[model samples]
Target: MSSAIDSKHDATHVDHAADPEKIHEQRGHQPGIFTDKDLMTNAFEAENREHEMTLWAAVKDHPMACFWAFVFCFTIVMESFDMFLNGNFVALTAFKERYGVPVAGGSKAIPTKWQSALFQSGQCGAFVGVFLAGPITNRLGYRWTTLLGLVLMNATIFISFFAQSLKVLVIGQAFEGVPWGLFIANSPAYASEVVPLVLRGACTATLQMSWSIGGIIVAAATYGYNKRTDEWAWRGPLALQWVFPLPLMVLIFFAPESPWWLVRRGRTEQALRSIKRLGRRSGNQASAEDTLAMIERTVKIETQTGGEPTLLDLVKGTDLRRTIITCLMYASQNFAGNLIANQATFFFEQAGMSTDFSFKLNLINSCLQLVANVLAWPLSGWFGRRTIFLGGLVVNITLLFILGICASITQSTATNYAQACLGVIISFVFAGTLGPISYSIIAETSSIRLRALSTGVGRAAYYVAEIPMIYLASQMLNPFGWNMAGKCGYVWGGTAVVCFVSAYFGLPELKDRSYRELDILFHRKVSARKFKSTVIDVAENE
Candidate 1:
């Protein structure tokens, strides 16, 4: 019955004049029975040409689609809250100053090391969460997996209001790892899939923008609330975070399911409907035919391979090599020594400032980072990835060395403030370039089948690296007394040098390429420009 249906469909496509030239090109495979099936299949495919044309035309004309695009952007923004809140412990500097335990019999010493240790615990929790995401998403699918994370995230934040002990604080922040991991693992892939290839960079960057925006909001809220009130300041910000996930939950309820997921499950009819909806929303800029062709090609690839490839499959060939390299690339971002440098408000206070001074300085640094994220759009848009990636590493490396010198010379004096300001400036510079662009490369480089797993692996590396970096930054700077913290410049400077070398030899140009083409670029010996050309050809042909 299935074969008969397929034959009839083939005949219908042939009568409607499917792309004969392309079909013939594919059919000239070899003198085999399989070649004959390809020709028959091409004939059946012709009937859908009209459906393709209409579906595309409708998508191009649809207005709601544009609105949904923004909906997509905002959903991603909610996830960006992880980055925003990740470092927000700075806002508690004042409270810590008045109430925190005294260190080594000091009258009013801030527990900077203790605080960093706590935060690193949260990062470690997030690592566990990231490791768990692959299996959860594999069993539950992206939508439900996100929903589960969202629920946990919101509950934890709300529960944080009741915290009286440091243990509870750690738990609140640690459980935060779950939703943060889920979103970080899945959101990039979702954003990458939703947009057309031409606007891929900008669209993905918009997700980064959402992150910056969330950071700005967190900074503004934490700074403003802490500045005005002495008590219940942290509570306000904690309570307000609940609002972030609510709207996203409502929208995802109404939004279309991922077409790729449907095709993977062999739900072709449903996938076609979802594609039509996407086309309708995109103002018909993409047709149903375009989406179907994409799904069809993807399905064909998977079917030919017999099943979804695993991590082992990645290790065997160019595809696996690309995955490993990309994972390391993201890992480098986490280990870039920037997070410690950026979130060092408590460290700054421990070094010599009063609690109030640390809070103000941390606010200022976050604000600067927000501004840098805004500014990055133009520079990253104009410059290619290689230049920005390498250049940023060099600039950061130079600053880290200079900072180490200043820290050693200043030793706990007024000059420390100057060194702190310089550190913030470097933070701004790093955020502007490598921040969003790193995400772009991560999203572009993985195959669809393995996207969730790859992203989870990459982010897991990031969080795992965070454990040591944050730990070292605190212990070496404080109790362990490595003097590296006091003159922390050399450590970060060395890290900067490593990043520069990595960028020079290891990174590939991923600018303006489709996700599919990225699959090829990572696997094949194609140049970046040629990779872009190949993707365009694939898109146009579809």
Candidate 2:
């Protein structure tokens, strides 16, 4: 994901040692001194050895890096905007007129089965798309694959914008999922490649920030138009998806290819030039040759023995833990009560807010998420990734337990207000920490060699988790179904507690360690608590 810095650090262009950029970081051993297998063993030969740039050095260096990172992150805004709007549209009065089923008596229209299918269709596409990212990204390179996704998304949005029936809209949404799957699975990897290890936390945080920005804009749009009677109510919002993707189509074409990808493909000259461009733009102190030298050597060493890894390798030996943890981390988001966010409109409607005000509350909710992402940079770096994530888990457990209790006790105007406020609190806690920080965990944990495939596989786990939850959310929240409002909190509250336990035990602290260093730590099966203080050598020279 290192777009601007062009694979600036380690071979993968991400921080090898976790300094919070986990996607591209690589632990080093003074160049070619160790065999690929020894990449981990020799890393532990020394202790308390600092490798790479200081945080100040990373932040103060990259102006252009920031620009490119924003470009990379903005890729998801259209997707986020579309998704948020899609959910809230069901809450609209006009939406009922268009898609709702009639009740036996003279009651308000209820959401039909087709609408549930429409909501799940995108996930269906996303599931396939995320799994496809590994092969495509590895074969075509990150920039082009991303551009192809944008083109596909735009075409699908065009179909959805003027959709005439639920079938058409469902088809469009499903097609739209393909591109987003690529973005979610690969965007962090691309960002990691371009930024210095020091800036990894802030840059990767942009991935989460982008989603909130789109959600905020779309939520605001929903507030403005959900009350309208004509087709403009829905059509108008779908058109807004176009706004974010247009500039990206052109901008991505011109953006530098990831040097890590280029180097892997044997395009040494192009990789060097890309690195040079990023360094010049970002005001980086490291030379293109220095960065490219590490990249070339690292790729060469990994290739020499591994002979190009397959998906099977992700589940074998050291990477199995990485794969399992990363997958569980993505799965944990929903299990840990992110389902509340996915169906926020219905949750708000149940909590006594009008559809319009609920949408506005969603807008506010997105703003809080945005602010949380902004704060994640400093907090994820200073306090360490595990600490902040564990804190978020605790917050989730407490807030959700309180909500679960409240929902079980009563249903009234005052209670409704309390439930809504608590939902807001939980949104802040979950979105700020778990949602954004998980990218760091997935990216930082994987080895550079398997980063693309493993991340894709992990995203596959996300879709797997999403499928049942979609049905559960429908059954629990829909008027046509169970309609268990606050009581549903109890279901996911238990899941959050499970995630908190898993993370405390299984998720290690890779905060400032290189990927190579992480390899050693995981292989040695180091205790999660010991990772932060367990110093090891990461010599940049070979």
Candidate 3:
């Protein structure tokens, strides 16, 4: 099949060795022999070498890069911990007694409006933080920006830990979200830049693993405290957040900066130094130089194609298409039933499960998600990104549809149990597929020149979409509001169908493709269906 497709586009492959002058003409320079032929050749050879390297070989060659990527991506656990704490707090008896108003059945409940507000306030701050991250990282670089965020996180946790009222807690969540935005937006891009192509998908996907780790920790903490009659039950989880930032700050201070960012800033010497630090095990100065040249060439092509990178350029030309794909890919997490998993503790309680059982189920759900995320690292390498993502979405849609059917029938212990179980299954499937793969896709989809900013935009879109979904999920679960219960599955399942369709038509297969190859394919406007099959010679001069 690949052979047939390659033959069909045989005319499209330009041979720079045969017609070097054509490269200059097509790239808007005068027809002439290459001025930096050695640099171009080294870059071409490096890209090909990277494309052919196995995952284990890449890991062995770049151990320091892997270590730093893990350290940076670990910052996401803080954000995930806080978000998970907020969602489960509503189910805490002491929390409701303190912050909630009177509801029916002679019991106290946090008003749906306040629940929605508390959940969305963080998202609002994250929205601002994501947009702010692009410019700040561009100026300060990833390491400094990360340190700044950690410092701010240390200061902001005071508000939540010491809050006297719900309003104060809301303000605290919003303030804390600013740094979280920095972490989420920066970490995946950092992972992408630090590692080789074979490690890129797994490293970026490790962000989701960190997130699930946070979820698991919070789940266990919340379960441990769910039955307590004092405010300490809720405050314990909030205070535990303080443990993450300082240690991460110390580690991040020692981590090397992104070489790609350095190259873009014209700090070639520093970029080479950073590359050496990243690939220390290889200890080959020549290989490091070739890698540096590869980054320089990709950056040059992006600049020639898109001119100066800006926020506005995200929506211009091929970049607009890239930006849309990244944004929607991130947003699809929510549309494809993640809200149900996120709010599982509250969701199960409202659906008539016992409070103790609900918390236990939430803990189980978190554990499953964590394991699924670990499994995804190998699955991603085996099945490829597009296949795993689309397959996961289909399974999610099917389970949610079945859950809705169970809800539509008579409400019973059996049906409620079925719905709760289905939510957990949906979450497991998501963690394995769409959840992790989206990180790789968004990181790979954007132009290297605009990668940090593009990732920010994509993450911002996730927070943006999350706010409404959080609100709607609150209403659907609240007895005083929509009271949809398991019926919410039908609505989310319908949305997941939309995501699957769009992805089928729009999500290209990016398995094992180098950044330069991706840039060439996007520049030429290749159809998504043709991406895996279309052949291009990376040796061809841009």
Residue pairs clashing in model 3 are: none
Worst ten in a row by lDDT for model 1: 533-542
lDDT (tens digit, per residue) of candidate 1 on 308-328: 646565455565656765676
CA-RMSD of model 3? 2.8
Local distance difference test, each candidate: 0.60, 0.74, 0.87
Q: Rank the candidates by TM-score, best first.
A: 3, 2, 1
The window of 10 residues in a row where model 3 has the poorest summed lDDT is: 1-10
lDDT winner among the candidates? 3
| lDDT by residue for model 2 (251-354), tens | 98888888878988889899977877666554343455556665665565456436676888888877788899889988887787777776687788877787
- Predicted structure 1: lDDT: 0.60
Give me the displacement of residue 51 in model 2, in angstroms. Answer: 4.3
> What does the lDDT read for residue 186 in candidate 1?
71
